[model samples]
Target: MTHPDDDDELIQELALAGQGIALVKMEGRVFLRFEGVVDEAGLHVPYALVPAQGVLAKPSKWRKLEREARAALIAERANERARRELDEHVRAFVRELAEECEDAGLAPMDFLHTLADLQTSEPAGAIFDRIRQRLGHAVERQREEQHAERTRQSINLAEYPASFDVARRLPRRFIALLGPTNSGKTHKAMEALAKAASGVYLAPLRLLALENYERLLEVERHGKPLAVSLVTGEERRLAEGATHVASTVEMLDTRTAVDVAVIDEIQMLADRDRGAAWTAAVCGAPARTVYLVGAPEARRAIEALAERLECPLEVHVLKRKGPLAMEPGPVRKVKNLRPGDALIAFSRRDVLMWRDMVAEMGHSVATVYGNLSPEVRRAQAQRFRDGSADIVVGTDAIAMGLNMPIQRIVMTASIKFNGVEEEEIPAALARQIAGRAGRYGIHEEGLVAGYDADTHEVMRSLLKEKPVPLNTSGFAVAPTLEHLHRIAAVTGETALAKLLKRFIHNIDVPDGFFYPRITEDQNERAEWLDTLPLTVAEKFTLSLVPVTTRVASLQSAWEHWAMSLAKKKVTRLRTDDYVLHHMTLQEVEDICRLYSAYAWLGYRLPEYFPDVTLAQDMSREASSRVDSMLQDQNASARRRRPRR
Candidate 1:
């Protein structure tokens, strides 16, 4: 298959075609020349990850697609990683040779750049090697030995506790309330927090933080109301003379000593992206008594943390207050859905679509998903709780946030798209979602099943399976600004991206227990922010902001926020007039999150992003509008339902 016209005949004979590729029959079978090239076989250029639209007549059947193009893409991804490694090597040279450059009369011009300075295919370290050779091998060897010693001492993690003076001063005690879902362990920890004279609750989610914050403010103890502060990336409500505080885990105030601190979701120490927050809270919470509440899977991780921190720990394993049991069979149809039911789907589209089908069957529906704001999810959950909505359809967002009187959970499918491809859901996630059934006071026994026979069997099998135990690696640790600044002082480097790379590669960790983790998103954000004229601290701060870059709108807003901050301008926050006029659910959700990012940035850079209150107000309004739209959709669906 060489010429364009002959390619048609080849595709017709093979019953498969892709963009710009040639194939030849070697044996009985043929393979794709995915790499587009002017090869002898007359292959053209390869299309991207997706094949050409009209070329793929039967995509599922054309499984053999591998020639040079696919291999080239794999090489490109590998090269992308190599590029970062090359950047790191350049950073090491910058750190290890700053003094050598000064001695050789080139320090002034040697503020070495990142890999972005690479103009050709030449390696970034070649110039540094040339400098090293010019400085004489004998002098360079002695200097290298001395520099290695300094780096080892400067980047040691053995003294990590000393970084948190408030925590180091206290004789802390850990109380780990480890158990499965519906075990009431978290409730017990919250009870202790409520009873403390002064305390803080560190929740994993903003919704959970807000819910507990409101509870602390509303509940009176000893005939007097307790003033409480609400702090999270999304919003903040500072109470007057607050004795108690409820904050998202990342907002934990380790500097302020408290009588007690409650850290929810102890098992999240296994999380890749946010686990560092949990580690920081556990190691740095300046409280006399700290409650670590989460699944039993986290018990070992907590034990490792307590041992390393030299804190006393008491372990308590609790039993479920209400037993969970699988249903005998599937519901068979949407009509079989019960009033106190939570139907679980994996995607926002699936959840909304399923909600419509349920509503069209004459059931009142409320929807919750990751894209929806916490306010919206809370309101939808309220509807489900108050019997205003007969059933709730949601993604995994509903699994952990709210406490509903759900008697049964129905799984829509056993498979979900995990950002890449459709794969069978993990047993642990399915169990966590299913465990939402039968609250202690709400229902006697929790029942779980699937919407169909196959799904029901999958659920039944998953319930009996056990979750894997978490590793006892001290915990995932991320760098604080203090650590970064210390690195900068010692290494004479100013680039934030280089500082992070140094943290991962040059840091000396003892016992390999505390593995350093910097998420891919953070590194990517740092690289992009490096293009602007910003301080290392500013770049680091922007990198950590809770911005979901997957959404193009959110990504643009974050970039705009960073650019505005770089220009030293007050980024005014206002609702788009068109958004107010024609607010689609997707648009409102995006705008609501945009306001959240604004509010979050305001707290960090108050002078620049100074619209905290306005952003919060706009966020609430957007959420309320979304809630109203949900009700309107459900009402419309019910009206369209065939009345029996």
Candidate 2:
């Protein structure tokens, strides 16, 4: 009654114990062939065993061994595949971790060591979670440190000597002219500056400075032309016996005493990037009388500053001669646009496109944008002013001080992309731009409208409302290298720019005042220049170089210029020649900027940048050529378009 299964199990057990039949390969097949004999019941008995023939079978042992071997082979293969897959997964995970570390500016080797120290065969998600948790903790610690540093800065700024203190030492009367655009704020201030026995006009733009400088030179003091000088970052044209200086706000000389000083665009005090210059001019201008001109938004801030400085404050509110009202609907096409209409766009592409579209409608077009040189902007504005251009297309650069006699203003878009995000134009900025439509005596009324319902609504809303009053003013503080070194010693930070930032932020200012945030580009450039083996003065000059940091070609050109100067070699600027003749407007503009940067460096360090005079000359030449090219292009486009 012995079963076959029982006999196979018995044979397997004996085999495992090395007492059963051995496996053998015969005729390309594996078999449990053994030296044994079979009895009448088909069971195999071992050679050592005699009798018991019907108790076991030979086939059962062979099948059992074969099945066991196949099962073993399958299990081994499965384990090997799993090991291979696990290796690939580990490699991919490590590679991703390394890339992430590199992007985060962390050391990959350190990150790998951290992963290894975890000492657990965790899943990818678990490992990533752990890494992120560590990174979060590190970030939290850094934030805490920054907070502590800023707190220290606040304390220091409180004890720092403010511009008000500087003003208190001088005998000055402050006059603030506040109103909306086209209110004659700057006109009245410039008039006073012109009448002063000796005065300085601090303008917010080079074009404005040049405009006033020329006007002053045209005035007669005693039946003879009066003394006037033009001083900007890039160009300085000094008249003989010049008692009146017209300069950009950043170039205002705070040490020289003048009979009167006019600081135009005083609302710029709220500008986070360049407000500090306006603040400095107001607080430190050594004039007996100082004229502060800007929108009404800065009235309270200026009044507070005047009160703190103990200067007699006079406020003048000017009225607009022409009225401004919203148009009824959107402008759908350029064909309906009349003469003296300006189309405002927020981007260069839009500006050019609108200009071309209008040109095809048989209207002469002029463009004004930030990239255009001041000279080119002045020319474009002149074309609009003198009736040569029927329509003007421009960006927000027109919002500043450019004067154009337009009957109507048309906004193509309500939102602007300000490098970071698309945002609706601020009410203050909208008012400034819309106000430019009707020059007081030129147009009886100025009309403002947008291209769509949403834009029209936004424009109307902005026009009806005034900008919120300025509550805070920010300034840049340039501390001495010695002072920065001391801060570095205290903070244990080796980077000069970081130390400078720490020192600046640590300065405790009044509630309404703060240090401006340094841009990432500026900080990066500062760090780079700091690594160079240059004198403190040289480093400062390089730090203030006016090149756009975002452009790689400009940066390369600047680096070459700096290196040549460091080696005391004669350095010629990239734009030293008139090579921008056939270039695009944008390229020409970039070259003009390079020329300006060179001129700025030359003015700052004449010994190192000896070719500054040549640079300034080249800048003027390139600007004039570009302006002529623009005029020709516009004229040619107009000729090509058939009259409607």
Best by TM-score: 1
Full-model lDDT, candidate 1: 0.78
- Residue-level error in angstroms, candidate 2, position 83: 44
| Candidate 2 local Cα displacement, residue 426, angstroms | 0.2
Each model's TM-score, in the order given?
Answer: 0.78, 0.73
**Residue 320 local lDDT, model 1:** 89
Q: Which digits, one per residue and each the tens of the lDDT, describe model 1 over residues 298-394?
A: 8888888899899999999998888899888999899999899999999888988999999999999989898888889999999999999999999
- Which candidate's lDDT is highest? 1
List the RMSD of every prediction in angstroms: 17.8, 14.5
Q: Give a tens-digit lDDT track for model 2, residues 601-631.
A: 8887777677787787778887887788778
Give candidate 1's TM-score: 0.78
Q: Please report, in order, the local distance difference test score of every candidate based on alpha carbons.
A: 0.78, 0.72
Lowest lDDT 10-residue stretch of candidate 1: 45-54
